[model samples]
Target: MSNDRREPATDADERTMLEGWLDYHRQTLAHKCAGLTDAQLRTASVAPSTLSLMGLVRHMAEVERSWFRRVLVGEDAPPIYYSDADPDGEFRLTEADTWAEAYATWQAEIDTARRHAADLALDDPSTGRHRRTGEVFSLRWILTHMIEEYARHNGHADLLRECLDGATGE
Candidate 1:
């Protein structure tokens, strides 16, 4: 007989449920990026399009870190991908770096974001005033925003990865 050891789902398992969904999405992004070389991951398929597997990874890293650490936690510092002079620097790859470095950088950002989220209650308020609009929101809103941001980018990553080398799926 085949073995199945999955835990039974319970109605009270809200935390586990949220985490499972979050993990599934994160894994999908990672799977889309699997088995890609540095050049393949970094290459731009069409002119004037900044979308690439590596660029998406970097972009998501910036998103996660910016929302969870900088905005939610109210860090008095610049965002990882934001520069006053060049706002598009996150999508622009100006250097030829190793694949390992790219993946490691992404992983590091993901880890930090996860740790920060785990430590905070979702209802926790943002520490600083928003620059764009004068509004206040809880960390819960930030996390949900991150999920939506990732979902959109992951879809783009799916197409970009397929175009890079015919790879497909989450």
Candidate 2:
């Protein structure tokens, strides 16, 4: 049988459950990205939009920092790679940007996300409010949202990796 990216367990609590799913999704993205050359990863054969695996890596790192550090922690967390002038900059790559660096940043951001998340209970509310709705989100909402974000992007990573080297898997 194929190895499950997500951890399997029946008796896990809420936080553990969310963490497991999120980690699984994160690892899935990394697995899809394994062994790709920088140029191959930069290929946006998916077309008009530049959503390469490298872009996804950088984007997810930004997402984690924004949610966990900015929204949840209420710290002055800003975009790490992308900015107002070039929001899609993460996907815009050159020969210099290595997959190794992107993956390293992604893992570091994941660790930071976990570190920040562990200090709070699922029921705890955000230290900051939502920008659009002006509402404070519960930790439960953030966990679920993060999982959803990774789930969607990981699907894209699957397709991108497949196009890159004919490699595919769950």
Candidate 3:
């Protein structure tokens, strides 16, 4: 309940609302991981599940890079974690993985994403196509999808944090 996340404005314009909600969710994820030790950040939620706060941060970095840099801006950015050989590479933490690195990478990706989308119209089509459908997406669609993605993962983060400690909030 000690979160610093800003609630999205209910009376804002469409673009404002979307960006605000996305940022709110982003801050929510950060809040969930704050004040945790390295071990706590890397600790898996439960047996047979490798989902951890650190992993989520890494995974989100890859996601932000993929959607914004690779798709939206047509950059040749590659995945930072997962690949064909290991699709869940981000989630499979190694001894070398550190919260500092993961958080930095995630923050960098967020910054890049904001920069790439800053002046683009929401209706503008992405330069890249979906890997499966070969269909191009609009910035609006991508933004909405990102909001959904973060919302889902933030729920998992909520559970993870609760398990790690006793913290819970909206």
- Candidate 2: C-alpha RMSD to true structure equals 1.9
Ten consecutive residues with minimal summed lDDT in candidate 1? 1-10
Backbone clash count for every predicted candidate, in the order shown: 0, 0, 0
TM-score ranking of the models: 3, 2, 1
Ranked by lDDT, top first: 3, 2, 1
**Residue 16 of model 2, lDDT score:** 85
Top candidate on lDDT is 3
List the global CA lDDT of all models.
0.70, 0.84, 0.92
Candidate 3 residues 35-109, lDDT tens each?
999899999999899999999999999999989988887788878999999999999987789999999999999
Least accurate 10 contiguous residues by lDDT in model 2: 1-10
Q: Which residue runs of candidate 2 sit more than 4 Å off their true CA positions?
A: 1-6
* Residue-level error in angstroms, candidate 1, position 70: 1.1
What is the C-alpha lDDT profile of model 1 across 59-143, one tens digit per residue? 7777766776677766664656558887877677855655577678778877876786787676778776566785666866776
Candidate 2: count of backbone clashes, pairs at least 3 residues apart or interchain: 0
Q: How many backbone clashes does candidate 3 have?
A: 0
